[model samples]
Target: MAPVPLTVPRRALDIVVALALLVLLSPLLLFLTVLVRTTSGRPTVFRQQRMGEGAREFTLYKFRTMRPDATGPGLTSGSDPRVTGTGRLLRRFALDELPQLFNVLRGDMTLVGPRPEPAELARRFPPEYQWMFRHRPGLTGPCQLHSRSHAALLNGMPDPEEYYLSVMVPRRAAMNAELLAHITLTTVVRYLARTLWYLLSAAWDRSGGSSGRPGGDATRRTEEGRSLCVRS
Candidate 1:
């Protein structure tokens, strides 16, 4: 299948859905903002430069999830001490990413597509992944689905930054290219639904506080390790 063009209809669909979600989720967004401010101190939002379509740079927004004084490489590990208490909760269900709805509204992103890479990472990507730059970055995508969450991916890694750069980036880029090639309305809806399911599952786990999922983290880490090894 050929890659889906960024047609007028697709853009319109993004705008309408993004606007509706922003309106519907406004209360939760406001509450999260206040919570982040009170818990993490001022500067509730974290904005970083990310590469988008045609390698354009744009400010990607998320609820601040790390301490202001924390200093380290850009990559975050499962045991990173910089992640705050509230930040952990926010990240568990990916609530920190809610701010990107505004980006979608502003036309910097889509609800489903290749997740945007940081500017530095984008500059280092191989030519095989260059096709991703032709499309608007997305809040969720095939790469995001296939890969483990940040905690799982970085678990027990000797060097999280190096592991991510050397192993994860290229794998995700290839998946993103594959997703872009066969992208359709049905594919987009499937990806969105899967993302929502994961979010809900994470929320349930958080609420239950480890009812029956013993050793879940270890199992996930093992799976992630195997996945990475397979590609290696």
Candidate 2:
């Protein structure tokens, strides 16, 4: 086999963690799947083609957060009218992304790396940024940790897709390249830890658990995750 950027140990870790998470998160996944079905009416899981390792394409899954018939631009802000109420909650904390754990199990992705581009948008990605296809796209990574910030920027855009390709994509490409350049066991571990914290914090906030104060514990934890993304 060709030597992929993902090392043997990293792949081992990915498999172990992915399996454990699938087993542990199964109940929550079931609940969410049912919730989406009941709330949005069938097709609980959304499937889309995404660009992956070596520029290969594969189906990525997410717990559906939009109406079964909703159709519009792929890039969505929190305010996208197509998003259902359940989906708004799901998107706020990224609960919609939980299904990608299966993608990790199936070797379509790793727990960490650059976020994948939509297959259709892959061509729009600048040729210079094409290097991102080297490794399997990650379930989460450095650039991905800044998703909320990017989404906020996107929310106000006259054209989310244009701003994404022209603005966010360059930043994402740079962050992805930098992280890959210095990838190490320590780097991977840090990313995984930060991701865990991010998920937990986001979930809490979305669940109406956020502290209502500026410098409260919840905000502090979120801020810490933001800082760690810069230096972790």
User: Whose lDDT is greatest here?
Assistant: 2
- Which ten residues in a row are the worst by lDDT in model 2? 211-220
Q: Considering every candidate listed, which one attains the maximal TM-score?
A: 2
| Candidate 2 structure quality by residue, lDDT tens digits, 113-191 | 9887777677677888888886788888987677665655655568667777888788888899898889877888899
Q: Residues 1-232, candidate 1: write the lDDT tens digits.
A: 1233476766887889889988999999999989987886766777667778777888787777766555554555555566678877776777778888889888888878887776666676667666677778888887655433544667567766567667777777777778877887777778889988876786666332111110111111111221211222
Worst 10 residues of 1 by lDDT: 211-220
- What's the lDDT for all of these models? 0.67, 0.70
Off by over 4 Å in 2: 1-3, 203-232
Task: Give the Å shift of residue 201 in candidate 2.
Answer: 2.7
List TM-score per model, in order.
0.81, 0.84
